[model samples]
Target: MRRHRSSREIAAAVFFAGLACATLGGMGQRCLPVAVVGHLCVDLAPRLREAAVLEPGRLFDVGPLGVSLGGCVANTGSRLLELGVDAHLAATVGDDDLAEVVRAAALRSFGERVTLDVEPGAGTSYSVVVEPPGQDRTFWHHSGANDAFTGGTLPPGDVVHVGYPSLLPGLLAKDGTPLLDLLRRASARGSTTSLDLAVVDEKSAAGQRDWADLFARVLPLVDVLSPSLDDLLSALRIDPGTTPRLDLADELAGRLLGWGAAVAVVSAGAEGLVVRTAGRERLERAGSALAPRAEAWAGRRFRRPVIAPRRIVSTNGAGDAATAGLLAAVAAGADPETAALVAVTVAATVIAGDRVTPTLLEDLVTPAPTTPSAPGDPAAGAAPSAPLLLPANQPRGRFYRGGAAIGAFRGTGAAEEFTPEDWVGSVTCVRGEPGIGETSLPDGVRLRDAVAADPEGWLGAAHVAAFGADTKLLVKLLDAGQRLPVHAHPHDDFAQTHCGTAHGKAEAWYILSPGEVWLGLARDLDAETLGRLVTEQDIDTLLGAMHRIPVAAGDRVYVPPGVLHAIGQGILLAEVQEPEDLSILLEWRDFELDGATDGHLDLGFPLALSAVEHSARSREQVEALLTRADDPGPGLPVAAEEYFRLDRHDVRGSAELEAGFAILVVTEGPLEIGGVPAPAGSTLLVAAAAGGLTVRGNGELLACRPPVAR
Candidate 1:
């Protein structure tokens, strides 16, 4: 998909794009890149009026005829590169004038990374597509050089996608021997094989072949198979137009997976996309070269309609663009759900216009090389810089269960469960400001007062100079014994207008234990719907609008202010955020809190939802917010850096941290600071005057600090 940028923005973007291009160029041309190999065609699409009539052999004036790249290699492959994916195209085109046009476009768009086989005397495939408003499209198609693509020398990559195999006559010959041979060869060549289908003419040699038999043979070697509902029906020798759309797609997807295809993507034109992954056992064995990514794919099935684009226009290459998105994300190592979201979001752009300006899905992309480390023994690395280890400063909350996690850290009694959240070095508190839910330290020595007494000793001199003796950050060790309610936090503007507060809670999560969480709106939720849901206490309706994301230990989640979110059951996490507790809860049933009374922060439902973001965030956008649970170094998402800062200290022998007033949560390993043994399961304080704590032993800790002023 292309990105539309204004002149000034485009010029500025090109600088970064140039940098990205240069970096990607430095990598091997085929390294971890998506290799698209299949049919090549050019589509001539003419838009007709809603009431336009056409007679046989009649030519009339058309509204607008758009000429653009067509077929698998160009549509999907080219779009992949446009979306910032490392992709190389390999397709066969005829030795003709149209071939030169295709070749030039390919070379210009993809640079020298394109691999096209210009066969002398071969016909370049072309299609005359008639798109009339309020009517289905009819195609006058010719499969020329595409029919000659009989699994030619494919490029080397982790994943290889072969599109329109059904349109390639030579590949479908001999009971699909050619296609099987191609897939097998591609697999053996150290590449995971993917397949996409094309609409075949009923009378063509390609359609007359035994597709049912061919699918059995070819699917076993294919790792990913994506076909439209009609295409799947054609393969099954059934009329898809007469069958229920999602049912038929699901049926065919299941059959394809059963036939040993590790993943199945069923496209229902205009309706949406359904993706299913094989079982774990199958993923382990049938994933072929893609097994390393199986954990991200196995045993998942999700269907999503296209995300709404900024505008509605010709849907030419929407599916291909979406496929490009999936492949691009998968190639970049995103999980299945995240990849599917990227697909829908990308496709949304295709439907919206010729180019896509990225919104939410752009967050899924991080530089590939600095990938976070997989979860491991945290104590086996370098120590963080901070020196002092204070005791857990947990304040009681009705729904928190940090006692177990904190107990596990301190090696105390059988670690009874308590809903104690870590609130270290904080200058802000909801109850303290209201003089309710307030507690003091031993002998009425409040932690807030203690910090104020020695601002330079606890908070750094810089922190005191910048914002006075108060620390601006608050951290929590939250154990979600039950799912939290759907809720949102106001932003600074909203809080200032509604709550008389200086800051709003824009929180981020660093998962200490793996589980699921609900984040943002899965669909564009209108204020009426959200307000009604909250007023009526329609829990399902409220939650159904949100995206449920599965997370793992060490994952990072960025929750911007005004975005609705909920912590799922059985998740233990360290939450860092701006120092406030102004929550506007949407779903509070079956929990200890009273929705009618306490859920809305004393503000009525009508006014509270104003603090909620009503915009639609497709599943892809929500998944994009979850970082791949790999990075070990202070892995807070960049989106959250402005609200708060986090550092993951993997201590081996020693390490140094920047001098600051911060809360420390020890996640793993055995370690000590300033001769005090702070093992796993402690939330302590570090004095800024400590001037960077030096770790002496092996352990892992998280340092949570406030936002740096602009």
Candidate 2:
């Protein structure tokens, strides 16, 4: 008679099969996404009354009024997206006529990523800009829906652009729910933020003071803060008269930097611009033609422009355009000098045009190609790459092993198919097994079982002896499978006395294949009701109430001691755990492992009851533990603790390993270990003894370390 496999067996079989397929295939890399906030404002240039006086009854015709979306939501954000950046926009608007106009404009410019937060009866803001020659432009502005903009209207963005600070008074509300507070919240999640101050009148000086304090508070969190010299001096209360002429801009930049900006740029009209770093400043003169003629100066001297533009028109949004250019370059990982150059180029282009488009800018801007070069080259001009360390073939000294073995080599040897029977009887986990041994690990580490001749020498004799006593987690990469039991493990306090162990099981995984995984606290009870569930053998009801999630490869799932969880089919993963095996299985129905009742590992009924989690589960709470590799590239590091520090190292050619003790486990390709070829399934023990090793070759490696406390 043929025997039917248990649910655990079926699940294990499917997992391993899927894992094999993933080993042969590759996953695509992802980039960091971006988001923009604030409302789009249409600036009406010709409608201004000042234009009427300049043109004198000619209907104040100012070059077709140059209609386009402005504000953080449009100008800065749209430019980023057009530069191949993954960007989104979040802005408040009225559901009225202007809302439709702005919404349609945003949709046409940014597509679906633009989110319009609409409030009834609110009107979208608009501005009338008048350039009346020989002075800064005058603005007639209205803050419609913008005045009602609140914290709840904010959206998620990696780098937020808070534009036109004067218009965002609600953002500076004295109440705790300030919009700036919301921005702080977003920035706390690894997002960088920036602010743009508009030209304001002296009459609103008190309002300006409030805005200055707001800037001071938010500036520390901001990566870059760009404001014109005139606007900054007015807001900061710095009297140009009192300040010394020598290094005045440098001093101002230094103060701003001290407030937490990485860098600052001050634009001085006609005098050109000054970019100050932490230690030095670079001044780029205005284009030569724009500079005052030498003969006209009569002993007075003016700086000459480094590069002259072919033509010039309006400088209306030149600063804004330059700001967008600098931000875009920075977002693309360019260096400071390159970013500044890009900014200057962008500003010049905007000055020459009535309006700018992504296509036009892309066509005009030429980015130099970046290439990988040997380390220590000053002109190598690329972001530093990971180091490469070759492990020595011979031991530098005596090798000792007392640390717990987190990973091991399954074996080496190319095989066409993997069977349970073949794996069940294998004594040595090494190369030449019935599994693919050529594929690499997630990081740059290589894999393969230790040879029989060196098993004790490689894994330590003591480690092998304690294999039975120590918790053993078996990971079977699956292509298909049945659902296993929903379960939890006793807490450390309960386990020490009841199970003769101090630690309870807490495991996490990095999924290698995409599929559904069941997880959560088993019982549907609140914290108050948890004690009752534990008193009763309500395993079936508890498992039924837990949450089930469908996950994909490169996704991380964490299971705390009290969370009842089980992985479904089609997943290959690396599981980390505490050194204990105590568990409480809540579901046994449809399970075939060890006759459902006979061979299953079970916690005593009393102890099992004590382990039930009785609080309401939150999706956010769960996701906080699971790191998904949607953006920011493949083989990303998601989880870290003092107990263990884990990172995924993805390499194309070569990468450096930091100078510290870390175990490099190969999750993907054959890696060169100390000039020796080590295939997949091998775990190289990189000790502090290996100090500053170099890793070269293509593939991925998972670097693991003992919990920080150790």
Best by TM-score, which number?
A: 1
Q: What is residue 452's positional error in candidate 1, in angstroms?
A: 50
Tens digit per residue, CA lDDT, model 2, 82-131: 44556667668877897888888877776556767777897888877776
For candidate 1, lDDT tens digit of each residue in 1-710? Answer: 01123476556457536634643443332224567888888888877766456589877777767777788888897677666655667777898888888887776666655677767798888988877776667778777788777766455445788888878887877777777766754553335678888766677777677777777777877887878887766656686666779877888888888777888988887677888989755654332234544555679888877677787776777778878887776665566777777888888877877664332335654322222223220111111223433334444335434355544434321222344454554545544244322323211234566565665666656667777864677787776766777889999888878888878789999897888888988788788877778888898887887888889988889999999999888787888888787888887666655667766767787887888899988777776677766754456777787778887888889877777767777777556765555656655666565565666678788888876744
What lDDT score is found at residue 185 in candidate 1?
49
Count of clashes, each model = 21, 62
List per-candidate RMSD values in Å. Answer: 24.5, 19.3
The alpha-carbon lDDT assigned to residue 2 of candidate 1 equals 11
C-alpha local distance difference test of each model: 0.68, 0.49
How does residue 40 of candidate 2 score in lDDT? Answer: 62
Best by lDDT: 1
